[model samples]
Target: MTQSTANFKVGNEKLIKVLDGASSHLRGLLEKQGRPDGALRIAVIGGGCSGLQYKMDLVDGPRDRDILVPSNAVNVVIDPKSALFVSGSELDYSDDLQQGGFKVTNPNAVVTCSCGESFSA
Candidate 1:
């Protein structure tokens, strides 16, 4: 199936809510850093014990083949390789005292480690 064909049981409204929440925090961070030019890139790499890991970084430039997912306020870029692993993923930001920040909810995951940083495909 195509990358976009991956099904997300979550409703669009809810997905947008989560995306919006993430955008807000990212934008805030960029603003505090003086509004650099570029997008926040999210990627899943192979390294963690579970064999896959999630990572986020601010990229001032995007190479060709980067997938762009734009919200009303933010643009999220993911490399094609990573796109395959996170096709149906939703990124959300949490500010809870215990655990917080950009949390990726990936339906493609078969299992995730307790730290929520690694997963099995």
Candidate 2:
């Protein structure tokens, strides 16, 4: 690959941002699961009203070709295709009872469902 191409890919490696709240929450979750070395896996899935949704899980680490992003001392793993949809997105955490959980603020989403968990990019 050309130098510019390689530089571009490296630039996009940190496309997703994890907020302070998300980092803290995720770190707690990892500790609770007894996985200090674990990482959070974020993936886009089908079935939401907007045609896409996020499915997250805690895994041991990144698999082959998985993009690993370290932000706020937390490790996040995302696949290549999902990276496209979630580029420039920020991950945050909420502790409210009504809307409590990890949330994504994605700039690429053109439309979103009422549940706030699904979107069309």
Best by lDDT: 2
Off by over 4 Å in 2: 1-13
lDDT tens string, model 1, 83-107?
A: 7787777788889776777888888
The per-model lDDT (C-alpha) reads 0.71, 0.84
List clashing residue pairs in candidate 1.
Answer: none
lDDT of residue 80 for candidate 1: 71
TM-score of each: 0.77, 0.87
Instruction: State model 1's lDDT.
Output: 0.71
- RMSD (Cα, Å) of model 1: 8.0
